[model samples]
Target: MGHLFSKRKSRVTEHDKALLQLKTTRDKIHQYQKRSEATVEKDRQLAKKLIRDGKKERALLLLRKKKFIEEQLKKTDGTLDNIEKMIQDIEFSQIEMQVVDSLKIGNESLKQINAMLSIEDVEHILDETQEAVEKQREIDALLSGGLLTEEDETAAEEELDAIIADAIQKRLPEAPTDVENPEVVLPDVPETLPEAEKKAQKEKVAMAAS
Candidate 1:
């Protein structure tokens, strides 16, 4: 009975040692699970921070692009205004040039009209001078000829009166058709005495006396 009691006591001691080793292994596994869960939480926080930062950076870039576009639009508007002003200036210059050219043409036309009027007046004066010269020549020819009798003088005076009346009438009116187509009538010639007949009669009287 004493030997049996000692063997039983040794068996109980070996079972106690086995139970302690199992408890220690379970504690070590729990510690390892806790450490893994902590690492996972830390990684999730870092990913959230990265996502927020990326959104902020994109928003800032969009704002900068919008500002740049607005500045470019302002510059383009100013350039367009300047171009419009230049176009207006060019149009005004063209209008002014046209006006100047019109004035110059008008002045030249007026000068030409005045010159033509002066030429017409000069032609009229020359015609009057030629008529006066022809009248003086006719008067001198009549004074130098003594062949004009009183009847011829009277006839010439009547013809002169008619010519003066015609000239006076034509000075302010048109010339007559008969004056343009004048009849050129020739004058009658006188007969001449024969000198040979008188000479023959004288010779016959002398022969009878002999």
Candidate 2:
């Protein structure tokens, strides 16, 4: 029975048949529109010939026929547009169905995940881990005899300070009191330059002047 049901589900249904019918109708509409366009052109040429032959009334009648065919062409085009859009909308709706099903599955998975994990549960685990770490540290300190005495720590800090001061004093250079401050002179504003530098300076001044 299940196999038979699966077979029936695989078979083409009313919707598939309807879509095929719509496609056939759309093709027929296209053929009719093309024929009508040709008829409009033919009537236009006939009207032009009639006008040339001085039969203005006949020419106007032929033009009227052409206009009627043009109207039919417009109707056929509108019908074709509607049918094509309907087919496209139907096809897109199938995709939307699949997307909805997929979203349902994703939401179910998230629900399952949420069922397994809660905020309070996570916080409890984190608190336990923190307590475990602090306890481990306390145990280690107990085994290793804990920290230095206050007097021993003070003496160690003083020794470190002395070592850093001695290092700084050895690395420092003597102050030079005779060093002059450099003058801020523009390249082109130098009154005189050395012989080799003068040529380059003069060229810079010339370029600046230009």
> Residue by residue across 1-210, what tens digits does model 1's lDDT show?
133224322244443455455455545545554554554455456555656778656555555554555565566556556655655665666678669866966677777768768877989999999999988887887777655888987996566545544443454444344555577443433222244743453355446547
- Deviation of model 2 at 54, angstroms: 6.3
List pairs with backbone clashes in candidate 2.
none
Query: Cα lDDT of all candidates, in order?
Result: 0.57, 0.74
Model 1 whole-model lDDT (C-alpha atoms) = 0.57
Using lDDT as the measure, the top candidate is 2
Write out the backbone clash pairs for model 1. none
Minimum summed lDDT over a 10-residue window in model 1 is located at 1-10
State TM-scores per candidate.
Answer: 0.31, 0.45
Candidate 2 stretches greater than 4 Å from native: 1-24, 50-64, 88-92, 114-152, 155-210
Output the TM-score of candidate 2: 0.45
